[model samples]
Target: MTATTRSNEPGKRSSSGRMIARVVWMSIKLLIIPVLCVAALIVGLAIGYVVLGDKPLSDVFDFNTWKHMYDLVFAEGG
Candidate 1:
């Protein structure tokens, strides 16, 4: 084969390789979004529980309880 034909073969292979790389990157981003969201939520809930400390069982379900919990965990010195 001529030098041009040999070089063209590598170019075609690289094009396909680029396409595969793009697909894999997109797939990883798709998977990462939900994973990150879940991680954030779990962390938030854990911190919320710690800050809510010593509340009654009934109060645990209240909105204010969660608000206070969020504030305490996220607030300064919490």
Candidate 2:
């Protein structure tokens, strides 16, 4: 009946170790989800650019289109 009494049980020590390991594993999965989502979004955008070719992006960003959109959104009146 002493403090060293518990240390003598190998099964208890192994079970505690397993519990700690499971907590660490669950924390890692929780942190990985958001990082994985951002990575997927960046990769998806890159693939979209390549698949869409170059012309469409150029048209989307064209000066007249930008001016028209800007004017529509920010103009003093509709």
Candidate 3:
């Protein structure tokens, strides 16, 4: 019988599953940045409305608030 040699290098991953898992984790990390940005935007709007705008916290998230702002910015009186 002939002897065969199997190379087992140190720190080299032999399983394709580990590579796929690493790729999936990287993708998840990349997607988190945009989600965090949207969250920060919502928090900023809420804080601005409550502090600078002096509006109630409950009204900060109301649809009418944004609708009014949109209308004012696009007013036709110019």
Candidate 4:
């Protein structure tokens, strides 16, 4: 039971090694979800706007298009 033990079993990771791997996986999972969510949102927007809404594909990535949409939803009308 030194720093790391070697098991007779094949491909068995040491306890510390497994803990490190779990921490690394948790870190990646935390970061990956938000990135994947953003990616899914962009893809959904492209499909909805261009395919279903029959708008230009380019508008999906346009800054002004988002600005205009934001304004339409939130601008002061007075």
lDDT of each: 0.74, 0.72, 0.90, 0.92
Q: For residues 1-78, what per-residue lDDT tens digits would candidate 3 score against the true structure?
A: 999986788776767868898999999999999999999999999899999988899998799988999999999996
Task: Compose the digit string of candidate 1's lDDT tens values, residues 1-78.
Answer: 666554665445676789999999999989998999988986666566556655445564578977886898899873
For residue 29, model 2's alpha carbon misses the true position, in angstroms, by 2.3
* lDDT-sorted candidate list, best first: 4, 3, 1, 2
Which tens-of-lDDT digit does each residue in 17-75 have in candidate 4? 89999999999989998999999999999999998989999989999999999999998
Give the TM-score (vs. native) of candidate 3: 0.71
lDDT of 2 at 18: 90
Leading candidate by lDDT: 4
Q: Which stretches of candidate 3 lie over 4 Å from their true place?
A: 1-16
TM-score of 1: 0.49
Q: For residues 1-76, could you state the per-residue lDDT of candidate 2 as single tens digits?
A: 5665446765556777899999999999999999999888866655665576543554543678658867899889
Number of backbone collisions per candidate, in order? Answer: 0, 0, 0, 0
After superposing candidate 1 on the true structure, give the runs of residues whose Cα lies further than 4 Å from its correct spot.
1-5, 8-13, 54-78
